[model samples]
Target: MKRWMQHIMPPGTKCMCIVAIVVHLDFQSRGIGTALVREGTNQADQDEVLCWVQSSEAGRRCFENEGFEEKERLEVDLDKFARGLEGLEERDAERKWGTHVWKYMVKFPRQVD
Candidate 1:
């Protein structure tokens, strides 16, 4: 939807990109993640900025539930990516490796500026 956004978003609109959000394993299922993202969107709405994020699977779900839309995707071999992290300690479960897909999600303003 990157193309769509570029086409639809009015001229001179600003965007706020969320790098990431990590909730502890023990704190999963609580609304903290959603709340944090929601606050970002709310502020963006009031300030007329477009909210954006690059989210993982669970993060995509949370943002999507809060009305974020998928705009783009970057699929890669997470194993290779992890392997490139030289000298970094890793666990045995494929060392956080798999078909890693980074999703670009966004929340547009109610009315484009």
Candidate 2:
């Protein structure tokens, strides 16, 4: 759960640290991932910032359980992405990708003082 600080600074604000947590696949569903996220969030203190991630349904469920909500979404029409492509052209990439999931989601802490 090492957080990589990219030092992205907005106007009149402190730099933010982008957290990229890596939990082992073998340890899935054993609370390891949840624990890692909790520990990572515990590191934040008095910094006006944001944290985001791109995840699956299962991952989204986990984040939701931790009080995350869908703030933004982009419906990528695979047809547009493959409009002029050769192989797999006619196929609707959105349908192929299962309900057109969003690759990025942003979330903030529920507890704010």
Candidate with best TM-score: 1
lDDT of 2 by residue, 1-113 (tens): 12222322234543323345556789778887777665544444334345556555557776665545665554565545543443554454544433456534544544447
Using lDDT as the measure, the top candidate is 1
Q: What is the TM-score of each candidate against the true structure?
A: 0.72, 0.52
Candidate 1: tens digits of C-alpha lDDT, residues 1-113: 46645753667778787877888999988998988888878888888788877788868889998888987788897667565555556565555566878787778776635
Our tally of clashes for model 1 stands at 0
- Alpha carbon lDDT of each predicted model: 0.77, 0.51
After superposition, which runs of candidate 2 have C-alpha atoms over 4 Å from their true positions?
1-24, 45-48, 78-99, 109-113
TM-score of 1: 0.72
Q: Could you tell me how far off, in angstroms, the CA of residue 3 lies in candidate 1 after the best superposition?
A: 11
